[model samples]
Target: MRRTKPYFYRLLQLSIPAAMLVLAACSTTPEQTGLEPAQADEPETGLVTIVKPFPENSFHDLLVAEFAIRRQQYDLALQLYMKQAKQTGDLGVIATAARLSQFVNNEAAALQSTAHWLTLKPDAAEAHFIRATALARSRRPLEALQHMEAVIGSDQESNFATLAASALAQSEMDQQAFETAIRDLLERHPDNLNLKTGVALTLQYRNQEEEALRLIREVLTADPSNMHALLIETRVLQQLGRINEAIDRLRFAVDEYPYHKRLRLNLAQLLTRSDIFQAKAQYTVLHNQHPEDDAIRLALALVNREIGDYESAKELLRDLLARSDQRDNAHYFLGRIAEQEEAWDAAMDHYRQVSGGDQLIAALTRLAVLRSEQDGLPQARADLAAARLRFPDQDIQIYLIESDLLFEHRLYKEGFALLSGALKRHPDNTNVLYARSLFSERQKNVALMEQDLRQILSNDPDNATALNALGYSLAILTDRLNEAQTLVSKALKLRPDDPAIQDSYGWIAFRLGDLEVAENYLSRAFSQSKDHEIAAHLGEVLWRLGRREQAISVWQQGLNNKPSSTIIEETLQRLQVNLPDSE
Candidate 1:
């Protein structure tokens, strides 16, 4: 019995016809084109260039393959090309097959095709890069690194950043293979700045901030003017909770390398967290230096808006509308500005123009909200339904938005009906399931909430959100203290620093009669976030521990944080305690 290999990676849409045409055109040999004999000897001297041409006899199959691609039958196209490659032993056909297989995420076929391509053109940088990427994605880290090494000094070196990102993602899951592979690669290329920085980036992601910072400092010591090293060091410092130090580092780096766009942009972004005025000044400098760059202009506009310089922001946004690529972003920001100014008509007009780009969903949601206020909920919902048809890819988001609108209007039944319909259309979608679970909790349907959350957990057992939600719900709504403790403990282990998870853990501890443990966890959680829910928990735990004045102060702080917080009100009411309202 022959075993079939499953395809890996998500299937990308068919969008490589231009690339296919380039591959076909590059099939002509130097000899056939009457070029210099020295040019033809490039392959023998470890400088392999063009792929071998397809034989004339295989033209009919090639045409059929091209037709299959036109029909969006990528699998059929790849199969036909692979067959032609095997029959003719042609590098061109093998390269085509490899690319097609990779595009369709048929990693097994890609490996086979790339092996054949490499056999025919051993020094081909493109072939090596593709093979390394596939091997990395397949978790064959050692093999991937070997191929990656082949392309290090070649033109394909820049592409290694993508593979490094993949390695970092794997590292987050604590994959030993990638960790070993990076160490081995570093040992082989110890002095390579790119490799060192890439490894440091992975270390930074893994929360080994001290080690990551040390590596980045080594790079900076060797090349003090290195922009990448400076940026990475800032990130490491930021991760270590030294935001002011990070800002100061970027500020100094900016003074030294004033013309570097990325360095200045990063500095400006970092400054926004602490000093909006300073961030605006930096953006203004960047904008003046590169007036033609839409991204810089957009950043400057956003900073101006952040400083409440609405007129300046509007001017920059309106200017950006002249550029086709920035039009959607400009319209979206303009709509937001109008909304801030309470100019509903202008806001709707600008939102209407935002038909595409990342801001489309947000713009549509805001438009629906305004329409609901001006017209009616039904009209707003009808508009969203039309938007769902217009952007089928955002159907789930539209559905959720409509559900929120329903719940906002106290129409719980309509909200549930909408969620049920969404679940039918997108069966077992974890996001939809999670949303419905929260809605179910709102309606006090604990059984329904458990069913939905359990469905999500069954599919993704390590989902921290579902685990925490379920555990907290069980602790508050039912008497399953042991199970709640188990679930919440698991969630806390997964995300130990998360305030919400810590709050849940504290609540469970309090329920289990561990008041001291509850007080410690809840105090730390409230200190970290100052969230109303955490404050409520902390206040109750303090009250029970005979810290009455502290409990009142915590409850008052909670009310001051959010006067509309039902959590704080309910906690105080349940404990039969009354404090003066926050001024």
Candidate 2:
């Protein structure tokens, strides 16, 4: 709750143990992940045995070292790793050892050890990959990219090479080289859905959602057995308005990979939004299959929450949280369930024990939203200011939240200013830019708002949020009906069922003099129970359609739902609508 200078400093303490994670994260997650035993226990080769030729048995010792790491015995793991690395003078061993050292919070030691490994291994492909992995985890992307180049240059066929390439593509933004390598690899392994999915994922990071979808579909057509590809495709399809198509793909994946927990979870998520009964059935099946899977329990809790069983959801998360001995993540989910109960104070305390940058940010954002709702704008600003102070250089969505709060308070100018300010700091932040365009239209600043929306689309052509905002604005405010249609159609292609996006098309309908169609979309948006903007737009359309009484009723109800809005005031005055105000 209290803020200090750069709370990301806690990561430094975690970094000591994360050196090990650097090494672990970098290790070759080969096609053959996990030990299914080398064919019916054919002698625990190379591992399990102390090296007879202790001085020169480098590979054997390497396995031994990695084995100790897998066992989670850090101190013993470190000692064995050091011995093997020293005996062989192999730079790969040295680099891996440095990674293990990092796992124990010995960052200086890791840097020292890896530095020596690079010096000796000069040409070792695995060493470069390992070094890059450590550097990237340490938040040094530029340095990580440089080392990734070394890994790619040495050899592109190693198991380690695939991981290095994938990480570089996503984290280092090395798209040209990354796309080239991945596409080439996919050409031969066309049946390998995982490889193709990995390539498609790179497209996502580069802001190429259309291309990403294209790649995903290509893989799905090539081999429907690719469960991971199916799951990702499901998400894209759901976002793009092909909800049934996405759900069908997930259903197929669930059938194909029955034991795959991730596939089951993905299916559950899709069903939760599209079909509550199916979601409940899937959750029930998964819960029965993996009787102890805490995640399944959590997923079921979410289904309950969505279906108006809040008490059940709360009880489930609470039970799951209590039994989760080592599961910190479940605690964070429990906090969300607590939030549904309106137990603000409990949610705050629950979020405290959870770790990681992402979970911390979510907790902070939620806590700030609650404070903003409860105490007022100044207190909310202070909360966000504290978050900014805690994560000075991090991608904190402080501006986005502040703008949302300000928009609610009818401070449209200030709301837009926060987003513009955020764009100054993070020039390519799509969410902030999209929000600015939406709010700009509200303030009637047509030129500047359109410019901002166009900028977002220019940078991210498939930016659904910008497309919806721009189209919706033009429909409601300007006379660019054709342009509005084009933009809204593009947005529909990306996120068809999203209530806000549906609202955009409806607004366009109203502009085209199709009050019936406009009413349909606006009604759908209101049914989703999201924002006040939907209500405001629906009332305007209703007023135009001669549903004067209904229009008056809707506007007054919206104002009651959220009082103090210029839109409400203007609508009421123009209509001479009389209504009672809520206390």
**lDDT of residue 71 for candidate 1:** 76
Q: How do the residues 1-583 of candidate 1 rate in per-residue lDDT, one tens digit apiece?
A: 0000000232322223344443453453212222111112222212223555556556557667767766777788888888887987766567767767767767788789889978878887667767877876786655676777787777555334445666665544445566667767888888877778877876776788998899889989998987877888999999899999999898898888899889899988988899999998998899899988999999989988877889999999999999999999999999999999999999999998997999998998899999999888888999999999999998988888887788677787777778899999998988788777767777889999899989989999998888988999888889999999899889888989888888899989998999999998998888887778888889999999999999999888877788887888898889999887545
Q: How far in Å is the alpha carbon of 146 misplaced in model 2?
A: 33
CA lDDT, candidate 1, residue 453: 86
lDDT: worst 10-residue window of model 1: 1-10
Candidate 1 at residue 233, lDDT?
Answer: 94
Clashing pairs in 2: 16-104, 16-105, 17-103, 17-105, 19-102, 19-103, 20-102, 20-103
Q: Once superposed on the true structure, which residue ranges of model 1 sit more than 4 Å away at CA?
A: 1-141, 151-162, 171-175, 192-194, 242-257, 374-376, 511-514, 574-576
Instruction: Give the C-alpha miss distance for residue 116 in model 1, angstroms.
Output: 6.1
Q: What does candidate 2's lDDT look like per residue over 386-458, in tens digits?
A: 6677667644366666676786677888877777777888886666666777677778999988898798889
Q: How many backbone clashes does candidate 1 have?
A: 0
Per-candidate TM-score against the hidden true structure: 0.75, 0.49
The candidate scoring highest on lDDT is 1
Judging by TM-score against the true structure, name the best candidate: 1
